[model samples]
Target: MDARKTIVIGVANGRGAGDPACQDGPEVLRSLKFLADLEQTHAGFSWDDPIRLAPGESSTPLDAVVQIGTQLAERVCSHLRQGNFPLVVGGDHSCAIGTWPGVKRVLGDKVRLGLIWFDAHMDSHTFDSSPSKRIHGMALACLLGIGDRRLADVADAGAKLLAADVCLIGVRSFESAEAALLAKLGARIYFMDEIRRRGLREVFAEALQRVGEHTAGYGISIDLDALDPAEEPGVGSPVAGGLSLGELTEALTQAHGDEKLLALEIVEYNPYRDTHFVTARAIHDLCQSLIP
Candidate 1:
């Protein structure tokens, strides 16, 4: 398989973020014409239209999120089967509820998978623990097989990731219970303070090593909010102190060269909240680095 063969899955479900504007995340990114721009400089890249709930589809918020997840799972799985890497862009963090599971589905139950989550929140909430009860906040929990069974079943095989194989970075806005859950699950969290102290290069090198050591490969999920609000202000949940655009871009560029990097997903970008397309331009640059 050609390593450059890439499939882009755009998921436009905002129910998880509880912000209707987030549903336009994909469209916002598309408006930048990143793929078209990439084709001029790179080869073997293709894109699919953003996935959306059908007209008149009836489902609760949780159910709708899960459904979109399942749809994304199918797309990711198919791309993987053909030996193509799946790059998913999302309406919210909840898109991981399906993205990671789709990777697991492609690998089957016998193989183990790992995750590297770059985000401001742990995204480990449950209905019982969530202050807002938004599905986006609970995505990582669902991926680790801790939330509702409906979400846990998104992969159809089982939980897409294991706590021992997962790592979270730039976490500075999580609920107390969410932090506790990460501890209970044994997932590593690299808070903003540590990243600032150790620096992004060292921190990201450690993260890649930790997640890559035990598994065949790992899927990386980047929530735009993981970056400082000043740099990526258009996220669904913005945190004040976070990684800088240069730090994130440099770290990601280094990581993108890994042969064990199986899939990539970027989420929670809200164009409506952006000031003069700062977030959109950042997203465009990030995609350019990864695709080329």
Candidate 2:
């Protein structure tokens, strides 16, 4: 946040979800000129080459993810080494399998990594726990080093984030196994109900403080579904009661220019589901608010 130019990395992958249409998300946003104006407006804004799966890499979904994820990890790690902030735009939440690991590898072993995940669902499922077996639902688990070996062991051999250094906000949907896993690990989760009672501003500030504890820095990953579908329904998964744009945007501004804020990732932007580009604009504004 020290006025460092932001490097936008687009992850053009959708193999982790049931619908693979979002693999085209980064390209769609690029071609449609959604981000064209940002480059003109901010001197610090520019796009890094989008990450995509090479042909013949898809022997299996798992194989495809591992391939792209490895490439993405290298890309993100290289950017961090250059002292630019990495803003990862995603094809699906599964790109997280690479995002945090890249950040952690750069931070190294002595310092811990902290994350704030804003999503409608817990995104904490494991292959054994998930009924759908969609890897998108298991991103947080993978980031925490408890899912498939390929994902859990992304950068190092173990976890990218400790449960104590992580926080999940806007979680209204989750199954028992993932819930038990997080609960057993003692991760702090401010569910939708709690946010409703205490308010997003307060909750987000507390979450920021929670993740900031005993860590080098923290990052935020937002799933578009975390915003209420009635207000913004462009994501692949929509929840009825979720965060409002006004509140979320205002809350995000509080973190603006915070040097401790390491990286930002916003994912699950299904342009096909959008109603006249409302969600696209949401993505635009969200990034505008937080980028250093």
Candidate 3:
């Protein structure tokens, strides 16, 4: 693999700063040896400078995060148009609002973009339905053409992803109203129960097929909380009974080979809560899988 084929962007905007540990996530990954490993194992892979939140900004402030993220998105989109794969290492799930728009801008309407969201929470909440109004939970809603107008208008010339092209994977818990809204929009969803019965292979296969069917290419947005708390405890909202590290690795290995996979974003890594940097290592390994 050509080293130039991959462009990794580390976004260090700790939106859920209630736990300061997230702010150190990017550095933790670097400290744990992700950068050196990528260079040695995948010759063509390299990372861009980490994009951090503006100093003194509040994470829960939806408008502020949106502005910072939109600027970051522009940088990421530029790389994508150059045909370099973007591997976004995130501060929180809210980063997707900016990252997805960048992907859309590069692809335009020439290719339909499918979203594969891996998370325990639905992340489909609009401001009205959000209990805490944390921007992290509402990122997906913003990307899907609903939510704060400022965020909804992030894509180039004011475009957002069509709901029909989005799919939610591993969602086991969500607000009732958000669930109904997702159902109404006809979003494809594979809940935990469904995954348990069909198995990860079949479920992942179906997810890729659904995204492929609707668009020319797809973007994968993974929230670490989608993994079981026991396996990945360094997340803001740790959920029980989530996928294990091995299960997630298998799913990613398959997805990385898909021709239609255009971009990938991994978010919500809180190093403060992590046990001996296990989560950081897991993230590094996942990135390695995708590069080659």
TM-score of each: 0.96, 0.97, 0.93
* Residue-wise C-alpha lDDT for candidate 2, range 1-292, written one tens digit per residue: 1767789999999898899777877777778878778887777788899998886573577776777788888988898888888988888899988888999999999999999999999999988989999989999998888989987887668889899999999999889898999999889998999999999999999988988888999999999999999989789788889999999999998888888888899999898998898988999999988888
- TM-score-sorted candidate list, best first: 2, 1, 3
lDDT of each: 0.84, 0.88, 0.78
For model 3, how does the per-residue alpha-carbon lDDT over 1-292 read when each residue is reduced to its tens digit? 2334777788877763345456567777766665576777665677788887667765556656777578778977998778788888878887888888888887776667889899998888887998877778888888877877876777554545777888888898889978987888888888999999988778988888888896878888888888898988888788899988888788778876555788888888988888877888778777765654
lDDT of 1 by residue, 1-292 (tens): 3365767788888888767578888887776774566656656677777799988988899889978998998888888888787889888888898888888887777778888899989999999999899999999998888878998788584567789899999999988999999898899999998998999888888888888888878888999999899767888888899888887888878776566788899998888899988888888777765653
What lDDT score is found at residue 135 in candidate 2?
88
**After TM-score superposition, what is the CA distance of residue 71 in candidate 2 from its true location, in Å?**
1.1
Which segments of candidate 1 are over 4 A away from where they belong?
Answer: none
Question: Over all chains combined, what TM-score does candidate 3 have?
Answer: 0.93
Best-performing candidate as measured by TM-score: 2
TM-score between candidate 2 and the true structure: 0.97
Off by over 4 Å in 3: 1-4, 16-20, 56-60, 157-159
